[model samples]
Target: MAEIAVVAISVAKPGHEELLREALEGIVGPTRKEAGVLQYDLHRDVQEPRRFVFVERWESQDALAAHAQSAHIQAYKKAAADWIEHAEIRVVSKIA
Candidate 1:
């Protein structure tokens, strides 16, 4: 199976940037240690400080599914939900 890549963008509510950032950062360490996690990176938009992005690569669909069900991810969702004004997530395949 080919690898899976995920691009997730989160926009924090006004005055909630730091809180959302902390919640997002908290998942990095554990996610990197998960099985089949080729890459799991978090980025903050330079021009838009309230925007956060996650660039992730997984070994397979199963791996990606596992990641979605991870305890840390669940926690992040709970912690960031209220602070997030909106979110966009895309899963893609590498054609190159």
Candidate 2:
């Protein structure tokens, strides 16, 4: 179980920025309310609007798995599917 996860997502579509933002923004509330999530932050690329990064902390890998199956996350996925160019997700154990 990873205690932390750093997700680097890149959306390739030129016109899908709004969709991506909506999807990312939509999941924030639900993720914050989740029991497993300790912290979550979304970063948008200033130079490249298509690139986005999500830094997330969880109690454990189990918690992360739970987040993956969350309804809000699912809905966001659906909404942003067409706009997603690629998703690069990585889970890492917290050192601290």
Candidate 3:
């Protein structure tokens, strides 16, 4: 089966960019060490400093589901909830 690809985007509320970034960054190390993580990268928008993105690849749907329920992920979500202006997450497959 093809790896699962996920793109998660978040925009920080004004004045909370740094906090949001910190919250997002806190998950990288732990996530990278997860059982089925093929790749997990975080990026900040060059033109829009307040925006953050995570590009991730998982071995399967179950892996992704496990990731979503991870303690770190839940903590990040809770910590950044008030600081986020908008959020979007997409799961896709690479066909190219």
Give the least accurate 10-residue stretch of model 1, judged by summed lDDT: 72-81
| Candidate 3 lDDT by residue in tens digits, 1-90 | 568999999999999999998888889999999999999999999999999999999999899999999999998888889999999999
lDDT of 1 by residue, 63-88 (tens): 99988999999988887889999999
lDDT of 3 at 15: 100
Deviation of model 2 at 67, angstroms: 0.5
Q: Give the TM-score of candidate 2.
A: 0.88
Q: How accurate locally is residue 63 in candidate 3, as Cα lDDT from 0 to 100?
A: 95
- Return the lDDT, model 3, position 57: 95
Score each candidate by Cα lDDT.
Answer: 0.94, 0.81, 0.94
Candidate number with greatest lDDT: 1
Model 2 / residue 45 / CA error / Å? 0.9
Candidate 3 residue pairs in backbone clash: none
User: Which candidate, 1 or 2, has the higher lDDT?
Assistant: 1
CA shift of 81, model 2, Å: 0.6
- Of models 2 and 3, which has the larger TM-score? 3
